[model samples]
Target chain A: MTNADTLGALLLENERTRPTKPAIREKDLGIWRTYDWAEYTQNVRDFAMGLAKRGFGAGDKLCVAGNNRPRLYWAELAAISLGGTAVPVYQDAIATELQYVLNNADVKVIVAEDQEQVDKVLSLRDGLTGLEYLVYDDSRGMAELEDDAAVLSFEEVQADGVEYGRANPTAFADAVAKVKSTDIALMAYTSGTTGNPKGVMLSHGNMVRTCRTFLENEDVRESDDLFSYLPLAWVGEAIYSTTVSLMSGCSCNCPEGPETFRRDGRELGATGFVAAPRSLEMVLSEIQVKANDASGIKRWVFNTFRDVAVDIENRKAEGLPISLGAKLKRAIGEILVYGPIRDQYAFRRARWVYVGGAPLGPDSFRFFRAMGINLKQVYGSTEVSGLVTLQSDEMASPDHVGKPCPGIEVRIDDNGEVLIKSEGVFQGSLKMAGSALATLGSWKAPDS
Target chain B: MPAASTAGEVTLSVSGVSKYFGGVRAVDNVSVDIPKGSIFSIIGPNGAGKTSLVNMISGFYTPNTGSIIFQGKDITALRPNERAERGIARTFQNIALFAGMNVLENLMLGRHIHMKSNLLKACLYWGPNQREEVRHRARCEEIIDFLKLNDLRKQSTGALAYGFQKRVELGRALALEPDLLLLDEPMAGMNSEEKEDMARYILDVNEELGTTIILIEHDMGVVMDISTRIAVLDQGTKIAEGTPAEVQADPAVIAAYLGTSH
Candidate 1:
């Protein structure tokens, strides 16, 4: 067993160091409900002890399918802390698609969000012989579920842990102590757009090293906040929300739902952000639509400054020095248009914004930067533990994905395929490579 | 619904409370104990006297019989504004936001009781009134953030969407920072999404703010999802009172609402 520290251990260390600090917040009913590190750690311990009492130990796979919720994150840490591997499945997966992942992983326990997901698992319950428990976060409408023994509410699991803790006083600590760094921590399934999804096995060390390295390269502080509406199953979210945020003791905010992201984001004034290219496009389109509908003078002011912002962004990207007059014009543009737009989009406090998961359009990329948001492109895959190349602020062009992150090595072969070697690399899928494609020197400009 | 845990201290109690509107007995003899910091839902079909019962507790109507107790103190004779002063606030089934006022202004009006500025000092717009105005506005802004109404803060309440107008009414009630909040069909006329949003905000108010909520909602799904205890009112009589799960399974509740076998 590798003695290297696990992500769960690092989280415990963070708890010890900053127990009262805000760890995460979620928009509930209309309020940003906060959870401190001490509460977060206790929740994880409760889940761990509860699952442990249920005979979930070494080699057990706990399948978690849900939206971004704090409990889901705690479940992952709890599973990993006791030598169990967490498998986060996409919440939107259809029954047939979900069946494949569950059966493939041979999941022992399932922690689903609500009745919709519970129904999916229950429909396939007969086929999944290995499945033991179905723990649902939202127990609404679940009383009608036929299999009483097979299902338990999320609160019941935590209560079980509390009972277990009282019965065997040292049980929680003993279970946590049994976890080793080499243990498989998580199995994230890639979104199978064209074919069957493959599971990328990330160990505790891999996750901790990658997230720590990313933290080192970036200016992540405890004061930094993240609005995490992304899917927890996605590698990016796992890295940012579950791993790095814990590593840095920063607060992660979750929107009430998909529809409330813009409002929640503005309310949070989040400092760091990670999202897909599609979301960026949506924001761009939303801005354009609203700006177009404005009165004549307002539209004119926005359009004129928008041009100035574009010019400033172009100059910065080209590494050309800005003229005194251009700088003055950009400063005025910032006050007139850019600043308010950023505030409206909840980018007012954003120090770093990452766009990944699919290639982003250059126009959308430049648009955010033009609004004075420190937008950057992140290039990596699930096999790399979600960190490879991060565009630095100095290498501010949208055309080229910047230098590789700290402790990561990147190489290009004669075939023009990108090969990466890093501590963050998954234990499996060692030969994972992406073709450079026809856009070699023009690599920076993603497909619009 | 099974019985709610008798753990929470009873914050409000209505013993044999009944309201009569002229010849019609809008509410028959009813008794309910709302536990502190729990969502107590009053649900029934229309004309079931659910609203009438709520009106009695919120001081909108005088109960013709029996008495009401809050924190063991009898408040049966208190007026509506007087009840609000004693930490009771309410929202109407139909939105009651000031039509001429913007969202922020409407919310500020909710803080009127908290403001102690006399007209003599207020005429100069300086001194205690100025400080009080700033303080009240700041409190309203906090409610605005809590309700995610930053985008619509300056818009007139009448010009807003039905969903947003409902939200604004909720915001105004929240501005009171009440200990006991009476919501009258808060989710009525709202779409599913709007209902969900309202339900979440209500939950937040109950949990985060530690406010005891007496909710009147017809949306069974939302009521079941949020309410710690539920009372089924049918034909001006209390049919069932218990937790959501228990009430959902109750034969009497099913007969009255979901329909009888006959």
Candidate 2:
């Protein structure tokens, strides 16, 4: 693997090495549309040129708000190529919350996914003085605003990029070459449960190194597929779908919309899966609801095999060896119950499934493991560029998030707070200087 | 209150139309004008001959008396399929989608009248027939995108939720690409959120495609909000026809439908 420091350089390297390999897939018109590495980089180049033509440049922020769309991901990489930082806003944020994040970031260009998001942005336009352009990917209900000065469709901007690229052929390559590892690549805003949200600025090196170290410790490869259905505002989504895919050359699959997440996930048969505890609970409950409605004979078969699998899992967890008879029963249980359950939940091919963002219940955790899923818990926050600790295969349990990742040091203070020191730690908050450093330094004295 | 003036050329004109079923007058001398590129809604209580009047206009039930004119052409003797070919497409009060077929197949069925490949050519599935299939599929995909039915495109219509089935029915009608669209109680049996989404899609279809619409709805709030002109029908008779404000303030309309207590 190439040691590409910046995300833009990584994308360029992939395009050179594996131009025909699928880089991204999105479900559109009930079909999986593929974009190879060459097309992926070309889209980023065209969009970066378009942004430059519209006066977006170095250090400027481009706010993307919507579902996990291919265009939105490409927009993020395009901004990074132009030496700008991408700020992803939660798609479901209310107008006032959106207004706060947009104005706080001083975003110059906003790329919205569809009419719903476009309306949210336009409703707050009078208060956003720094906003220069409003770009929308879907044009379903935007026919009336075609001539509006401030609004432009995604195609129109891309067309402008084509024209600009024709005139200045080498401009996109030169811009990609200028981005440095120390430059800020992303500015993800916290959910702001306490007060106003703060923008966490992460440099290119922070993201690249963290993804590289994490991928090296795991078994992720170029052939792996990841189902990207999470909110783009979440740092975990940015890390796995964008940074990790760029590092490993894996394809990220996007569902058609929120309503089709499970269906699309099953269709993709993703090899790597990431979900929060709440999502796992939802899946578990769905299974229960379906099983409750099954015929008596089917239910009996399911229950019997499930109990057998769970019994085997408990013995293994207790450091007990399984006898040959018990092992044979477990194998039968795998074929009868666990195999079908895994296929139904789209986890049949998942090799590295991570559950994070909250503590998953032990019952639900054991239930998935009994169904032949390698479900593990990860621990981190946005401030540390997504992950600092991941549970190893043998240490898989519900209670503890396992050891610190490579290149990370974790220590517990006398006050019972965990302190982490790593190269992946964010540089600083966007507007608040020295606060993050101060918070980390305050806990460092006890350790010393 | 002043009458809501017609915006442009009259698209559909029903003059003195009447329908009868076993000596019972279903539609009695109903006459209304739908202007081009306007959303005109017809509202009334149950059994007020609202559906009868719409069926007569769509050529489902031929008027026993009076003539129907569309864009200055007399179409009183035309069949339902003939009217559909004349740029008039409609959805039923109850969803009329092909339950056995998926969303894409049902929408493609709507384009049957436009298909030119004969049986022999279609069976061969080569040259012109293949190109035609591709072209129609592209149009269907566009309608799917417009209505946000990409997720359900491959799903059976019978398996869809009530709201989504209604949307698919609408998408099928849209695949016909009609000039004047008819929607019969499109928001019936919907929750508030689904009703709101249907209203948005209706407005989008009208504004984006520049298609004239004739909507028959029971929700006064929705009818009042979206209609460019309002027509109130009661007992197979036209009670009042004007702007939403004019209809709401009319003595006959309030006493018959909106109630006079307010």
Best by TM-score: 2
Tell me the spans in candidate 1 whose CA falls farther than 4 Å from its real position.
A1-4, A139-147, A414-416, A429-448, B2-262
Write candidate 1's Cα lDDT for A308-365 as tens digits.
Answer: 7888788776778888988888889888999999999889988999887767877778
Chain A TM-scores of each predicted structure, in the order given, are: 0.92, 0.97
Per-residue lDDT of model 2, residues A1-448, tens digit only: 6788999999999999989999999998767999999999999888888999988888999999999999999899999999999999999999999898888889999999998999999999899978999999988778767778899988888889989999999988888899999899999998545678989889999899888878977889898998998899999999988998999999999998898888889888999888999988999998888878999988887888878777777888888987898778778888888888889889989997999888899888988998889999888788888788899889999878888898888888678777778778888888886657634632131211
**Model 1 chain A weakest lDDT span, ten residues long:** A438-447
What DockQ would you assign to candidate 2? 0.43
Residue B36 in candidate 2 has what lDDT?
84
**lDDT over C-alpha atoms for residue A252 of model 2:** 91
Best by lDDT: 2
RMSD of each: 8.7, 3.6
lDDT of 2 at A360: 93
Candidate 2: pairs in clash:
none
* Candidate 2 ranges with C-alpha deviation above 4 Å: A438-448, B1-6, B20-31, B44-49, B98-105, B117-138, B150-162, B233-240, B249-262
